[model samples]
Target: MPLMRIQLDSDRQTARRVVELHRTGKVHRESRDAARAEVWRRGRTPAGETVFVGTTNGEPVRLIYDVEVYRDVTA
Candidate 1:
């Protein structure tokens, strides 16, 4: 599966938010790691952006830095 590039803001708060979302089960470690690894592999870009690469069932998805967990209102 081709990895999807997920970029987050280069700030401490964004990093902390990712961890928080992970703890709440909103985000998976695999997804996070995949993203992190890709970033490390390519090194920092000229834009100085922090990116995370993830793939799910061969589909590409973009994860925002300031992600908020929202429960299903109608279920």
Candidate 2:
């Protein structure tokens, strides 16, 4: 899908984390793809947090929402 093409330098950390999640089976490839698509379109996570990613236009974009985390946080 076409994206807005924006700078996503800050999202590098989140992208790395997403990759780790996929590698460890915490998240599926489909999910990651969807997330990326959303980041490109919405320019953020669902919660309105900034996100970054490589764009379809070969540029970075700022995400406009927060990604959902299913991992245990009470530890």
Candidate 3:
């Protein structure tokens, strides 16, 4: 089975929320500071993350996205 990958920014609690949403109900490591992140298809719709990286002065502003993907390869 081919796994999916989702990437989010490391600012504005964006990554935190993405990880929480994709995260499975079943706990694995139970660590708030997990070095590695996990990816999951929530509700089968999204395809990929849409990040808009730029700067105005000295801060980096990014827009992240979580795609909902629905596809039954077995069927």
RMSD of candidates 1 onward, in order: 15.2, 12.4, 10.9
- TM-score for each candidate, following the candidate numbering: 0.29, 0.29, 0.22
After best superposition, candidate 2 residue 45: deviation in angstroms?
Answer: 20
Model 1 clashing residue pairs (backbone): 35-52, 35-53
Q: Rank the candidates by lDDT, best first.
A: 1, 2, 3
lDDT of 2 by residue, 1-75 (tens): 123333333254565565566456565354345555655475443333223332222235232223542233355
Report model 2's TM-score to 2 decimal places. Answer: 0.29
Q: What alpha-carbon RMSD in Å does predicted model 2 have with respect to the real structure?
A: 12.4
Residues 1-75, model 1: lDDT tens digits: 123355533345445565677566576455455555555565532233233332222223234421222233456
lDDT of each: 0.43, 0.42, 0.35
Worst 10 residues of 3 by lDDT: 27-36
- Write candidate 3's Cα lDDT for 1-75 as tens digits: 323334333554543444464454432232211212333323343334422222122234333333334464564
Candidate 1 Cα RMSD (Å)? 15.2
Better of 2 and 3 by lDDT: 2
What candidate 3 gets wrong by more than 4 Å, as runs, is: 1-12, 24-75
- TM-score, cand. 3 vs. native: 0.22
Q: State model 3's lDDT.
A: 0.35
